[model samples]
Target: MSEFRITGKAKLAGVIGHPVTHSLSPVLHNYWLARKEIDGAYVPLSVAPDVFVTAVKGLQASGFRGANVTIPHKEAAFAIADEVDPMARIAGSVNTLVFREDGTIHGSSTDGFGYIANLEADGIDVTALANRGPALLLGAGGAARSIATSLLEKGFQVIFSNRTAERADGLANELDAAWRRHFPKGDAPRLSTVAWDKWEEQLSELALVVNTTSLGMQGGPAPDWTPDLSRASSHLVVSDIVYVPQETLFLKAAKERGLTTSGGLGMLLHQARPGFKAWFGADTEVDEATAAYIRAALNKR
Candidate 1:
């Protein structure tokens, strides 16, 4: 590792969360800074929910370039931003915040972009699935909102399934409205909600399956059951937004069935690109070396 040093005039960026001690964002950004020899510093700040707004304002006042917003702060970040990107508007959240020269804050959601980018990084041609068939989304939380919006925008019909039927239905309705308002008339995507217990019945009709919940993450509950991929389409792709274990049981089952699978690490890496550029005025690339570095670090945890 390059022993990069911090100077008084270094560009500043960070991540804001209620409990940020476990975040790898600082490691990701600092790696790029050291590699490029940029005079910048990226850190993590633990800010309580009540003081999030005040803390953000203070960062802006302190000449900090920008910060990544996580957890409870994404929605609040959107509300405080002077300008919001279209993706952020669609997702109703913001993970990246940019402080401009005029002292105004700009917010954007890179989660959707990161999702797609991660698929592409894994050699999955997501564009080829456009109009191919419906996709199965396995959650209705914030992460699912972004992935659902992205799938619809990419021309795939979405089937939302969540443990709470009402939440799934509500998310489908919200996404439908957002889809209509964002896309052209004929390009509008179709969305439907499936009961949690009935998700398995619809599996055969899907070409892609995405798990956006914490069910498979470390310390989270394991899935009650695994889908039988043998009966599903051979072209089906299984992806999970949980990367802590690197290979969740959901992904391992898919692999065992000779199906394509993608983990969440790429999303974490790809999502950091936009924020880094906004803060340091340089574009960063997520290459194999970077992935190896992160994987090694994750393995050590």
Candidate 2:
């Protein structure tokens, strides 16, 4: 491996969070920068909740190109942004931020873009999934919002299931309204919620099942029950957003049943591309080499 050179003129980008030291953004983005020979640098910034606004403003004022928002800062990023892209607006959160020379910030959410990109990268035909049937999305949190919205925009009916019934219902209604407000004349994707207890019963009707919750994550509680794959559609594709352990128990169960499975790291990799383009002026590729580099870095963690 060669060293990455930087000068005072190098452009700056980074990831922001309360505890950002563990972020892999620096590794992923720097790999692209080094490979493409771009004179840019990506770092990690740990900003607390109370001073998030001040820190973001300071970054913009200090000539930093942009930063990726994480955890508690996504909502704040959306609120402070001078401009919000359609994806950010619809998802009601922003993970990527671009700083303008005039001290303004642009906000966008690439979570969904990355989610679908991950599936496509794995050779899963998203269009075919949309055509086959509705996708079952587990969780009603910020990540799920972006993913559900993205699937909806792609004309895929989404069935959202969360442990809390009200939260799931609330997200479904919010997304439906957002969809109607944004694409009034277009045929809205069917959005509905299922009780947590009932999600398994609908598996047979779903072509894709995605777990966006933290359940089964390392250190988190394991999923109480695995979906009965015997009753699921033969074309079912199971995905989980928990990537640290790489393959979550949900994915392991899916694999045992011989269903297609996708891990969350791809989303993390793919989502960085848009922000890299915004800051570095070039669209980066999420190739195998880049994936391998990140994987190696993750293992070291």
Candidate 3:
């Protein structure tokens, strides 16, 4: 740790995940650091699953303040954390880590808060519709788990749907939330799964549709599977966790049908927002100017 620290040099911060080359976090965060005039450098680290533990321990001991965790390793990150926030513990994932002076680690999962920030930015009223309508999620991966737990807390009825019914069912069971194999066909707004083939049929009662898969990421345009989002019966909002392309085909299809849409950028910023303040102090602000700059640069890719 002594060698890592230098007189009059920037502090170290970064993110860890497999194939982390796609991350724009360093860009987004560095802008904030500059604005705050903080003497720190943020970078992205590509740490594979097999090497994650060693890499994290090495980083902390080497004076790295903390880091953001991404896909394929959230659960494992949780296992290594000394303590976790309530949401992360319940979700069984960790997206942020803070290193204490005593070498103890504090972790938190920001996915839920990130999603909330995104939805709130779009003016979605989750509080007003508390338990009023059924929330439909499109995947059962790490991202889904965090968002689902958030939905449960907001008093919304949630339906877990995935290409694999068993996976969705498993998630629901873990959360103690009900799971359905098919989407609701009748007027009832119950939580149920919609077969991948029959997605169009279940689009009516879905108030919020969340995409947690990597469908609309860099090398893809989402799955060939498109659900009929043209239902006039309910206001369908399409939200995709993919931020790389900024706008995924899933959200684009929703807009073409005149439905509301959202992307992962909001979540990205909000998730990092808390940790930035925690590690850099409360005065640190990841302002809109910084976020806008990062978003524009990403669009060029």
Candidate 4:
């Protein structure tokens, strides 16, 4: 890629987290800036929790386009945003922020968008998957909620499974209530909770099995916790949202079982597309070249 030239008129944006030096957003955005030949810059901002609000205000005052909120700052971003999209409100977090000319910050969560975009990029028709059967989401955290909401919106029956049964139940109930409030008499989205230990039992009836938990992540809570997919149907699609190691254990097991699988890297790339356009006013593609670039960066790490 060519070197990016930042002039006085450069568009400014970044990613914010407490310890953000490890973020690859700079690489991703900078690559796009250089590729698009735009006078823009994307940086990483390490802001402590106590000063999140002050830092965000300072960024808005300094004419920043916006920034991607990461880690512990997502909730803070949502709280401080002057306006938020419905998905951001439902997810209760904001991963992307846009600073408007009126000095107001707009926030939205792109995790779900990214997740579905990645699947589509792989030529896995999400709507078709929904039609095939329900999706079994293997977690109840923020990521799970976002993915579940997306699946539910896509006409997929969403069943959540988490280590803590209460967390799973609560998330199911919460989303169910939200759906009802939004579409009073509309067809209720199928939302249910399953025991984490017994999620494998639902394999035959599921069209997709997603691991939104940190179980199979590289340095996550349980890196070795890949599930047995011996009973998975031939048409089942296994997906995991942990990208550090690229081919996570969960995906590995699915692949070994001769089932289709989607990894987290695609989701990461797809999710950043919206924020890139919002901040730089330029459209970017998450194609093979972009994926290769990100993979090279990951290999170096």
Candidate 5:
């Protein structure tokens, strides 16, 4: 790391969340800011839900570049954006925002991009995986939606299995409609749903399985819960989006079985690249050093 310094021409950005004291955005973004040696700052803003809009307007007025929205503010960010990318509109949330010189705000959801980018970064051939078989997503929440949309775009058959079967069905239908609307003449996306408990039985036919639920987070749904990967094919790729413990139990089981696996940390790192570029005018790459920096930060907490 180099000595941190900023001047009157420094670019400014931050993250907005209701209770954002724990966000790693500052750690991740500031690392890139310093490594690139750009006169920019990325901070964390703990704003109440009611004042999110006002705070955003204030940032814009102060010539701030942009801010990332997390948790409860993702939807609000989408609502306030002057324009949004298709991913954000389809995902129903926004995580990255850019304030243009013309005073317009643009919002985008990088979850999908990060999800696929991380897999590719791990040397998993996504296009070949899509050709192998369908992908089974364990939860149908926001992360699942974003991942599903991205997979569907890449010609993968996406299957959803959530604790609530109805929610999975609804997500499938919503995404199906959106996919068709986006590509009316293109092939309709292969989307389906399976019962939560039966997902394991069908793993043999899946090329990839992702746990988008918090089942394996350090303080999430279940401390010791992990999916049964016994029935998964030898080629099945396992992934989890919960990065706190880095190697979630879900990923552990897959690793123990000798199957390829990807953790959530890479997604977290890659997801910040787009925002970093938009805010700092630099393209950042995630390599071993970058991963180690974030891993050290997580270990500290």
Candidate 6:
């Protein structure tokens, strides 16, 4: 077993997920605590899907302030929360969970916030750009759903551009946005499908592109996106949520074009800030130094 290192602080906050060890939340939260000189501590707790209920209940029962959920447990976190933020309710998943003093759980998904942060960190003006052009979102999973949910409500023109037409259409319907079977040719930023063979063909006109698919993660094949995207992206903002690798091919292409590019790391850091504030207080920002180190460490890995 690894050594248990504890910083002396009475208050407890943690992140809950099956593979919680890989999370950077602890470093972010503890860094905030250290900076603020607050007498609290945060840690990571590994909890399997089947044990979610018990694990969450146990945290609430203890002095634990709250926890963040990741991956397979986001939906479970939402289902078990006593109350959920409006955005989280719409997203149908919760990544940032708060265990309140009243034994009530307040669930929220920060995936969108994180995605937005990734854009901002990479020098993209998220608020300005999202409002200006149509965003091509690439997946329909919980993470994509949350990001689309937020972007739509924010009045951004987000279109579903996934390979799987049915799921993408369903997500668009749920969000009350537009959807289609395939990317319509000849202009008009439309929400539709991208045929497996036609991704690169549409790269020239995209204003912003997002990759919600887990394709670039775990040493897998790169995303089947368009070529010269970086050059094409000179007029676009390109981002991907695959943070395991600091630079994915998707962003690499965008960077090559000198376009605005962002990685998944910023989103990880930004999304946790709101949750940490909810767990502790609004006065806290994620520890920037810690977060920077975490990013560096991840890049090195």
Backbone N/Cα/C clashes per model: 0, 0, 3, 0, 0, 5
**How many times do residue backbones clash in model 2?**
0
Evaluated at residue 240, the lDDT of candidate 5 is 90
Please provide, for model 2 over 1-301, each residue's C-alpha lDDT reduced to its tens digit, 9 standing for 90 to 100. 3354677778999999988887889999989988888888999999999999889878877789999999879989999998998867878899999998877788999999999999999999999889999999999998899999889877799999999889999999988888788878978759998988888988888899999988877767774435566777778999998887888877888899888999999999999999999999999888889888998998887
Candidate order by lDDT, decreasing, is 5, 4, 2, 1, 3, 6
* Tens-digit lDDT string for candidate 6 (166-203): 88877777655222212134233234556534655666
Of the two candidates 3 and 5, the one with more favorable TM-score, higher being better, is 5
Better of 1 and 4 by TM-score: 4
Candidate 4: Cα lDDT at 144: 91
lDDT of each: 0.86, 0.88, 0.76, 0.89, 0.91, 0.72
Q: How well does model 2 score by local distance difference test?
A: 0.88
Residue pairs that clash (backbone atoms under 3 angstroms), model 1: none
Screening candidate 2 with a backbone cut-off below 3 angstroms (N, C-alpha, C), the clashing residue pairs are: none
lDDT of 6 at 233: 42
How does candidate 2 fare on TM-score?
A: 0.94
Model 4 Cα lDDT, one tens digit per residue, 1-301: 4364788889999999989988889999998898898899999999999999999899989889999999888889889998988767767789999999988889999999999999998889898899999999888888998888888888999999999999999999988887887778989979898887898888999899998888877777888887778788999999989997888878887888899999999998988999999999988999999999999998898
Q: lDDT tens digits, residues 78-114, model 1?
A: 9999998876787788999999998889999888889
Find the 10 residues in a row with the least total lDDT in model 4: 1-10
Q: For model 3, which pairs clash?
A: 180-193, 182-193, 183-193
lDDT of 3 by residue, 19-49 (tens): 8887778887777776666777788999989
Top candidate by TM-score: 5
Q: TM-score for every candidate vs. truth?
A: 0.94, 0.94, 0.84, 0.95, 0.96, 0.82
RMSD of 5: 1.4
RMSD, every candidate, angstroms: 1.8, 1.9, 5.8, 1.6, 1.4, 5.9
